[model samples]
Structure formats: structure tokens, C-alpha cells
Target: MTTYVINLDLPGAVQSRHLYGHFAEHLGRCIYGGFWVGEDSDIPNERGIRSDVVEALRALNIPNLRWPGGCFADEYHWKDGIGPREQRPRMVNTHWGNVEENNHFGTHEFMDLVELLGTDAYVNGNVGSGTVREMSEWVEYLTRDGDSPMVRLRKENGREQPWKVPYWGIGNEAWGCGGNMTAQAYADLARQYATFLRDHGDNKLYRIAAGANVDDFGWTEALMKSVGCVGCNSSGVASPYQAISLHYYTMSAEWENKGKATVFTDDEYYATMANAWHINTLLKRHTTIMDHYDPCKTIGLVLDEWGTWWQVEEGTNPGFLYQQNTMRDALVASVHFDIFGKYADRLFMANIAQTVNVLQAMILTDPDTGALVLTPTYHVFEMNTAHHDAHVLDVVAKDAPVSRKIGDKKLPALSASASTKDNSALISLSNLDLDHARTITLDLRGREVTGVTARILTAPDVRDHNTPDAPDAVAPREWTEISRVDGGLQVELPAHSYVTVSLDLA
Candidate 1:
């Protein structure tokens, strides 16, 4: 039996809603067929943006969206994506598939999508292949008001009023595709570029410097030393960039053989879970370095890119990064969110890589039939949406069962996190054991619970997933096997399950 003692009186930092944010890059079908079907296409759409995808994502209460590239951002020239769609230049997407990119879904299209979804924008600018003036003008073009050169260009391109861009990324992976620069070299360039990313009108940009790849603590240290804090301002905030980013993807196997998304053995599953658990360590180590420099914790850490990276579906474009999402993916997401909730103070925002029809996508779209299927990972996001911006509740698990063993390490069978908001609290738990169900006791403290409702996301097999023909193969269903206990509540968590319990506290 696993017992979780949640202290209701002791609430921690408000989990930033942005932590549930998503990423949309110009990769594979994520952009073209997934989100955009063109205004004239047969698919039901609003001004060229697919309405189904919009409606589906809106259900997640998506807070923000990062756009226009992973490696493509560094190479993408903003000018080519503006003006008339017909006249917009056609360029080869050198990084992704070497496919020709007809500049149809550019700045205007993206902002329109943002408007439709009612989400904030996190735009990554070009720093590797683009000039300072180009990056500055792109920011000015989207956000600047009144009559400036960039503003006039924006108006000429059919948008008279300026758009609100709250978050802006300096570059993507500076240590890799964004430019093979050393940490110090990238840090110097970040400072210079950040200087020109001005706050025009009432819009103040939250500039995010492209941070480390995975465990490159030296890169994080360099950015902190060079650009994190130059001097304190009147308000005591002293970072050139408001936040720094980190990108880490969970691969069940090695880079060359990133195990199949839907097919894997128990050993592979345990290995993947172990890899997912490693992010907690990475966060702790990075936070230690960050705490040393800005003891005040003014600057934020944006885990802008993260998710499972499996091999491309066979016969699909390898560069497209298309893969199926399954019960395993949902557990991975649950684990990540649990960790994200723990580090809410320093980790302000996180965007899962490629929201639709790409790596660990929420929704998969069929190119031939125009069919859309929500992935298992999508349900986890919907179930845990209550934690967005809610106060974190301290949950201590005692005598948690060991799920399995990976090498010498004994992996825990359960993962849990709690948060409170308004007059209610949410408890999310994941049972990683593959064979047996575990009974859990919720030892609620400091508050009187009036009512409880629960939902569980699980499938008979961990490999179960949704296809266009069967969209609900692995979806959430009402979980009613919960009973009132002396102190709190008791739940029967089935194997390979993700459960969320909502409590009405008085």
C-alpha cells in the first residue's frame, strides 16, 4: 500500500500556467496538414487554420504556444513568410526533409492561430543565420505600435493593429544547429541581440536565451555569468534575458535506435521510465547553479522543448518525426508533469515539443483522409489542467511499491503530485507497475474535504493507442473505486494507470 500525506495548510508556489504550454515547430505534418488545411481546402477550417485541431487543443486550456522552428528558427527568414501568400518566396527547408516550404503559414497565419486558440505566443527569433537587424525588426514588426518602419510593414502586410508577443526566444540550439558556438560565444551574442529586442508600446518582451541541451551545466553557468546578471535595475531584476531554456527528450533506447513508440518490451519500458525520472536530477543540478548567481531567483527557467522521441513511423518521412502516441507516452507525460509541479518556483514555463502530428504529439492527422485522432498523451494534459497556476500541495509518499528494477536501481511503482486552487484541490497519481494494482491512501491534512471526483487514463496494454478508426482505444474513464477513510480517501489504482482526483475542500 502507498500512502500520500498531502499537507493542505502548506501550499507552495503557484504552478505557472505556462508550464502546461505547448510547442509547434515547422516540422513534418505539424504545420501543413495538421494545423493548416488552407482557406480553400475541403476540411472545416477558419481562415485556413483547421478548426478541429483548434477546437481539440482549446479543450486543454492551452496557455501559450511557441512557434516557427526547432532548427528551422535559426534558418527561417521572417521576411519570406510575410506579405502576399502568392508572392511569398519558396525556400527549401534545409533542416527538415529538404522539402520546399511555400511561405503560406507565416507571421500573420500564426498570430491568427494564436487568436483562434486564445493562447500567448512564444516566438523564437533567428540568430544563427539571421542578422541583428532582421531579428530586431521581426520583434518590432509583430509587437510595435504607432508608425515605425516595421509597423508600416506590418500594416502593409494586412494587419493594422500590433499583436501582443509576451515571450520571445533569442535562438533555438546555439550549441548545435542554431550555431555551433561555445557557451561563452553564444552568451555574448545573446546579450547583444537582447539589447535590441526592445519593449515597444505597452508590450514588454520576456526574452529567453537559448539554454543548454541536456546536462550541459557549464553552458548554463556560462549564460548565467555572461548574460544572466549584468547589473540590478530599479526593481532589482538584473538579467539580460528574462528566462533561459532547456531541451531534453526521453528516448527509450539510444539515439540511433530510439525504440518504437507503440512496441516495446518490459525492459524497454523500465528503461524509458528511468530516463524520464532523470529530468528531476537535471532540474535540481541546474537550479543549484542558478541559485548561486541570482539568489533572489528573479530569472525563470523555461523547459521550452521536451517530450518522447521515438523512431519515425516506418515508411513515413524520417525527417518528419512522426510517431504514434500510446499509454507509455501518457505515463511519460504524467511523470514529467509531476516533476514540473515540484520545481514550479524556478521552472515557470514548459512547452512539449511539436504539439500535433510530430514527436509525442497530442493529435495525429492523416494526410490522405483528413482524419484527426487525439493521442493518449492528450488526455493526460486534459486531466491535469487543474494544476495550471494552482498552488502546489506538499505530497509525501510513504512505503511506495517498487515498480521494477532497471540495472541496479529499484524504480518506484508510483508518482504523484498535488495542487490547490479556489475551493478545491487536485491530486494526480501514476501507477507504473505493469502487473498488479496498488491501493493508495490519501492522508489529507489541514482541510475538510466535502466531495471527491476522479478519472483514470489507462489501457489494458501499455502499448494500446488510438488510430483514426479507433480514437478512444486508450482514453480517460470515470474512476469510482474511491472510498472515504478515517483521515482522507483511499483509491484503488490499477496497473499502468494515470489518475486524477478532485477534492472539494471546506
Candidate 2:
């Protein structure tokens, strides 16, 4: 094997907190039967959430989770979701399946879920079909300590204390199901709604304005300049927008009557990986403009919603967005995470499209069998968790091939990043070439290497996936023989794989 070695001695570390983790929406199996099954299901649960699912997420060391949204946040009325379960109103989830939301999983339920997982809560407000009063009251209900109308209502509804929800989105996809507003129109509404949603003091709420769909720099530029001109204290001193939201999904086949899923040729796979890798470019473009306007890093690039977009399973409910999670998906996820790790400075947060039963879900469920399966992508998150909260170590790869196409192009076969956290050195590598496995020799140089261990996420076949029948098909495996040679390390990474090498300093 002709091995390649990455030298981490020269480059400084890259930030990892913004690899910020994922989300769960009120769509398809994600809500009703995916994450929440009420307090009475036979499956092992902690206050109604499946124990296995919770354990899977915890393993990922997930830092933050955005709740009750996508386009759903716009139509959601927080008040309708609280109070007595039976008395709480049932509303049709207009964005997902047009199914009745049983009010079973409401504010307290979601907050309880996040707390159980030991992750932060990023709540999205209802701006499309909800009022300023509704938005403000929800914030007060969650963050307020004093006995206000909303606080008293929360106590009456069974929760007496407050949950420190730090991140709040003004709207979700305002140009689409969020509100169907023009770029300028959404910015105006976001400013209006953000004015009333007050922070209750424990934590400064990171109020995020709804951003564009794809590469709409116009939306970002207009919103930032417009908000800046209005002055920082225009709508209360706490009203400054901390992050601007953006959403993107990588779909291999883009025509989209229903993009092909699961069954794909090599070209399709390559195209998908290429497109997924474009996140680096998108982040650069968006961040460049934000830097020009507010260069001090005051405003963050919140990739609030993102993940793989594929066709729904044929026999299943179309709106459920059920699809297979193959090793290819895992490879795509690996590259995306590396990109996020590189841009950790500018990118403050990101949430995968969902946690379960939605686009690129980390977990999948079969309610009838009560089966819970972790996808390959889930394994990637779990492996990369060590990078979280660890200050980023900057590094670069030389002689890596950059894939350029007629319309869209991307970088070469190798992606690498290093970080030193908790007194240990962690190095992550992504070998992007779909056909050939790579033998890399990492030169740690002066850094002493002891107790070297690696977690490799790869499958015998690129098409290998996790199914309800075989949940652990593509799970991670440990490789300790990846050598320490004369102040250097030799590792063999399979084709299109993600590898993480952990070393304890001698």
C-alpha cells in the first residue's frame, strides 16, 4: 500500500463546536413515532423517548439540537403544544404529512428530551402563521424566571422551572413554507418579530434571523445591511441578531420529481459526493459577505438546517421521507463534517435535517416492531464527537486532487484536520476517492505518540447499509495496528472512508 501521511505539527488547531449537531422536526416518523412514543409504549423509554435512540445521540456527544421545525416552525403555535395533553389542541402539521399533531410531544416534552441528552435547545419561533404575541409569550414561557403570565401558565401546565434555551430562530425558510415572503419582506418581518422576543437574563438568546434557501447572498447581504443601518439598539439592547440562518441539502440526482435514492450508479454516487462537498464553497461565499459588513465576527453563519435530500421510499408514506442509509451516505457525511471543522471559526452552528425518520436521519424506527436502527451517518457523528468543544487545530493537505466539472466542481481525494482537546491529540481524515483505498503515513513529528487508536467507518461494499433487520451492518470498527513509525504513523484507509486517530501524548 502506498501510504500518505498528514503532518499536523505546523498547522494550528481548527474549532469544532460549530460542528454543532442535528435537529428533529414535526414531520413524518420523526415526531409521532420516531423520537416520541408517549409515556406508555412497550419500548424502553425515558419519559416517552426511546432509550436506544437517546443512547445513540449521547454517543455522538451532540452539542445542540434545533426543535419543532423546518417549515413546521412557521406554522407551529407553541401555546397549542403545551398544557394538558388531552386538552392541548391538535393541529395539522401543514408542512410534513398533513397529519394531526397530538400535542403529546410539546414544549415540556422537547425540553425534557434535550435535557435527558445533555444538549442545548435551539427553539424556532412561529412567524408565518403565528403572532408577535405568540412568539414573545413562547420565549417568556421558556426563559422567564419571574411569575409573569407566561411563567404562571408554564407552572400550571406542570413545569414550574425554566429551561435555558439559548438559541431562537425567528422563522424557518421564509421564502418557502415559512411565510412565502420575498427576501426583503422576510427581513422586515424578522426584525419586527425579533423586537418583541425578549431575553430573560440567564443567557443571551442567540436570536437568528431566517436566511436564504441555497446560495442567496442577496438575502444575507440585504438582511445584514438593513439590520445594521437600523442600529444595534433599535429594538431593545437584547434585540441584536446573533446568527443568520441558511439551509442546503445535497441530492445526487437533482431533477426532482423524486430524486433517486438508495439505488444509484457510480456516476450518481460521485456526483452526490461532489455536491455534498460544495458546502465549503457555500460557507466561504456567505461568510465573505458577512465579514465585509460585520467583520468582527459578531454575526454567525448558522446552517440551522442541512443534510442529504433523497427520494422517499416507494411503499412508505411519501411525506415520511423514509430512505436507505448506505456507506455512501456515511462518506458524504464524513466530507461534510470535515468542511464544517475547517470553517469552525465562522460557522457557529449546524443541525442535520433531523435526528430520526427524516432526511439523512441519524436514527430510524419501525413502530410496529419497535425497532431502532442507527444509520452509518450516525456512526460518523459519534466518531467525530471528540472534536466538539475542542479548539480547532489548523492543517492542510498537499497534492490532493480537486474535482472540477463543467458546471460544479470540488476538491481532491484527501481532507484532514487536527485538534488537541482534553489533553489528547485527535486527527480526522476523509479519503474522498470513491474507487481506491489510501495508505496514509501521518508524520506527528515532535508530538509524542502513545496509545494510538483509530475508529474507521467503512463497509465491505459501498452499497452496504443499515436496515431494520440488520441495524449494525455498517457500524465503526477499531484498528490499533495503524503504526507509529519513527515519529510518524502509517495508516491504511479504505476507499471513500472517514478515519479518526486518537493519540495520548507520551
Candidate 3:
């Protein structure tokens, strides 16, 4: 096979902090059992939130977390989830499953979870089911420090002071579940709702308007221009919405016929990857529209919710939306990190659908068994965390082919890139072809490498996955040097694999 190489000499711009953000919704087992399981559970936890899960997230160096809902955000009422847990009303989760939401993991629990993760909180407000007063009061309840009813209520409920929450989503998927309003109508509603969200002294809440879904640049353009009109006036202060949110889910199967999580034909796997690669286009097209309106990159594009959506496992509740993470999922995660790293400038914040037990969740929970297992995607994130906040070095590899029934798609068996932090260089590479392993040669170009360590996440087969009994089926393995050529290093990458090469520069 032809070897692909990344010349670290020609590196792109450094990465932005937004690339490290994550999303956590109330869907499936993501919030309740995965992250917050009530203090009564036998599992290791802190105030209902899982301690191990929090530690795992903390280890990923998670930057920010968007919360409340996906479709749930639309119908979510902030009041029902605050104050005391017992007094907090129980509502049906009309979005995810018809399961009852007992208000156990409310605003306090969420903000507290973010605190434990050592990340900033991005709360998605209810523009669909809530009013201006309700949304604004939520801000006061969590952010206001002065003497006020909201603050007093907050203290009486337990939290004496306020938590500084900066990013606030005015709505979520407003074009759909948020209200199903036209761009013009949603823009007007956003104006009214945003007007009431007070900054509350020290906390500068970036009121992010619920933005476009996928290629709907019209929504972004209209909202940005209309909101820019509102923001430009009144002393020409910066816009109330510091960002605009967008959501996209890449699915290989149709809505009803979503493909299997692990058992997939080679054709299905390639098509799935093709769908994931479309993210590059989504970012480019959305950013182009935003650039036309705000050239200086004033407003950010928040892919608040994104990940692979597959059919629910057999015998599992359809509303649960849980699927096993396979090696293919790991490859998808790695490629996503590469795409987001490239677009770090325009992409402000994002969360990978969810953190656990939901669609493409990093952690899965079995409440019955009291078992918690990290998914393959979780290991991919952990491995690639080195790319966080590091410079994006330009990587170029000649296209390699992965043949499928449709046609010969450019597989690029060897995909590689470099990121530098301090004096260390982290090189991430992937071998895309499932059946063919490739020997990749890296031209270090004269950069002295004092030592090298390799970590790989792969499986004996592309379809290999982890169950509760086989959680470590596809985990990262420590590797030694394959070979050091005269001026470069040659590494053998397995078929359908993800690898991270760490170099300690002298």
C-alpha cells in the first residue's frame, strides 16, 4: 500500500478552546442513570451524579457542557426542575421516551455536574414551552448574587450563592421542536426572549439563539442579520447572542431503518463513514453564511448536539435510543475530532450528542447490574485528548481507495495529523480500509524525537464491539517502535484502526 505522510513543517493555526466542549441532554439514560442517578443508588456517586463518570469526563479535559434537552429542551419547564427534589414536579419525557421524569436531575444537579467535570455550563432555555419571565428568572436563579426572590429561593433550596453560567441557549432546534416557526418568526421570538435574559452583574451570559439544522443556512443568515439589527442599536454594544446553535446527526440508515451498531456489511460501514465526512461540508457551508453576516467571527457556531444515530438495540425501549459503540464508532469519533480541529476557528462549542448511554454516548450504564462500562468512542476521545488546545498542523495525504458497490471512494488508508503542546507533539492517524493494513512512513523532517510512545484502539474485526461482559473488547494498547528509518519512522497501522503517536521533542 502507498504510505501517506503529514509534514509537520507546514502546520495550520492553533486550536481554539471551543473544540473541547461537550453536550449532555436528558435523553435516554444520558442524564438520569448515566450521569445523575440520585444519591440513593449503590454505585459510587456524589449527590446523585456518578463519581467515576465525572472523573472520566474530567480526564477528557471537557471545556463546556450544553444541557437540558434535544427535543426535551423545547418542552422542558425550568420551574418544574428547580427548588427541592421532592417538591419538583414529575413530568413525562415526551421527547425521548414516554418515561416519567421525576425531576431528580434538575438545574442544581446539572450545574453541580458541570462543576464536578470542571467545565463551563451551557444551559439551553425553553423557547418552545416557556415564556420570557420563566427563561429570565432561570438566569437569576442560577446567576444572580444580589438580594432577589430568585436568589433567596436558590438559597432556601440549598445553594447559598450563585454559579456563573456564561453560555445560555435561548432555544434548541427552534426551526423544529423549539417552536416550528419560520426564520422570521423565530427571529422575532428570539428578540423577545433574549431581551428578558438579564446578565446579572458578574455573569455575562452569551444568549445563543437557537440556530439552523444542517444545511439550512437561510435560518442562520436571517437570525444573524435580524439579531444583528437588534444588537447594533442601543449603544452599539456586542450582540446579546454571542453564538448561534446548529444541530446535525449523521445516520447511515433511514429514520426507521437505521443500521445496526456493530453488525454491518462493509458497504454499510463505508457509507456510514461517508455520512460522517459530510461534517466538513456542514461546517464550511454554515461558516460561509455566518461570515457573510459577521466577518470578524463575532458570533460562534455551536453544534450543540451531534453524533451517529442508529437503531435501538433489540428488546430495548425504542424511546431509550441506546446503541452499542463499536470500532466503527471509534473511527467516526477520531475523524470528527480531525474535522472539528480544522474548523476550530468558526466552531465555538460542541458536544458529541451525549456523554453516556444515549446516542453515541461515551459511557453506558446498567442500573440493574450496577455496571458501568466506557464505550469504544470514549477511548477514542481519551486517546485524542492530546489534540485539545494544541496547534493544528497541516496534514496532506494522497488519497487511497476503499472500493464499495457504489464506486471507489477515496479511503486514504493512512490519515494523519500533528498537534503540538508545549514541547510535545501529538500525531493522530487512522487506517480507514477495513481489510487491509497499511505501513505508514512519517517524515519528521529534522524535528528531533527524544522518545516515542504509541497507543492504538482497534479490534480483531471491524464489527467487534463491547458488551457488559466484554467492555474492554476494543481498547487502546501501548505499542513500541516499529522501525526508525534514516530520517523518518515507519509505523504499521492495522486495518480500520485509530492510533496516536506521541513524540517528546528534544
Q: Which candidate is the best by TM-score?
A: 1
Measured against the true structure, the TM-scores of the candidates, in listed sequence, are: 0.98, 0.94, 0.93
449 Cα displacement, candidate 1 (Å): 0.4
CA shift of 487, model 2, Å: 3.7
**Model 3: how far residue 6 lies from native, Å:** 4.7
Location of the lowest summed lDDT over 10 successive residues in candidate 2: 230-239
TM-score of 3: 0.93
Q: Against the hidden true structure, what lDDT does model 2 obtain?
A: 0.79
Model 1: worst 10 consecutive residues (lDDT sum): 227-236
User: Once superposed on the true structure, which residue ranges of model 1 sit more than 4 Å away at CA?
Assistant: 228-237, 400-403, 408-410
Q: Which residue pairs collide, candidate 3? A: 11-394, 23-351, 69-73
Superposition error at 388 for model 1 (Å): 0.6
Local accuracy of candidate 2 as per-residue lDDT tens digits, 1-506? 33334443443445646465688888888877888887888888988988888887888778888888888888888888887788988888766767887778989999999999898898998888888898888899998987899889998888878889998999888888987888888888888887887879785688899997788989988778765632234453332577898898888866464256678887777788778878888898998888777655667789888788888887887777778788888887877777786667778888888889888889888868988888998888888877777766665443454454624575566777677765577888877777787777776654566678898887777778898888788988886648767757888877877899997865
Compose the digit string of candidate 1's lDDT tens values, residues 1-506: 88889988788999999999999989989999989999999999999999999999999999999999889999999999998899999999989999999989999999999999999998999999998899999989999889999999999989999999999999999999999999999999998999999998999999999999899999999989874444454555467788889999998877888899988998899888888888898999998888888777877999999999999999999889999999999999999999998889899999998799999999999999999999999999999899999999988976645666676555678999999998899999999888889899999999999999999999999999999889999999999999999999999999999999999999
Tell me the TM-score of model 2: 0.94
Each candidate: how many clashes? Answer: 0, 14, 3
lDDT against the true structure, each candidate:
0.92, 0.79, 0.80
Better of 1 and 2 by TM-score: 1
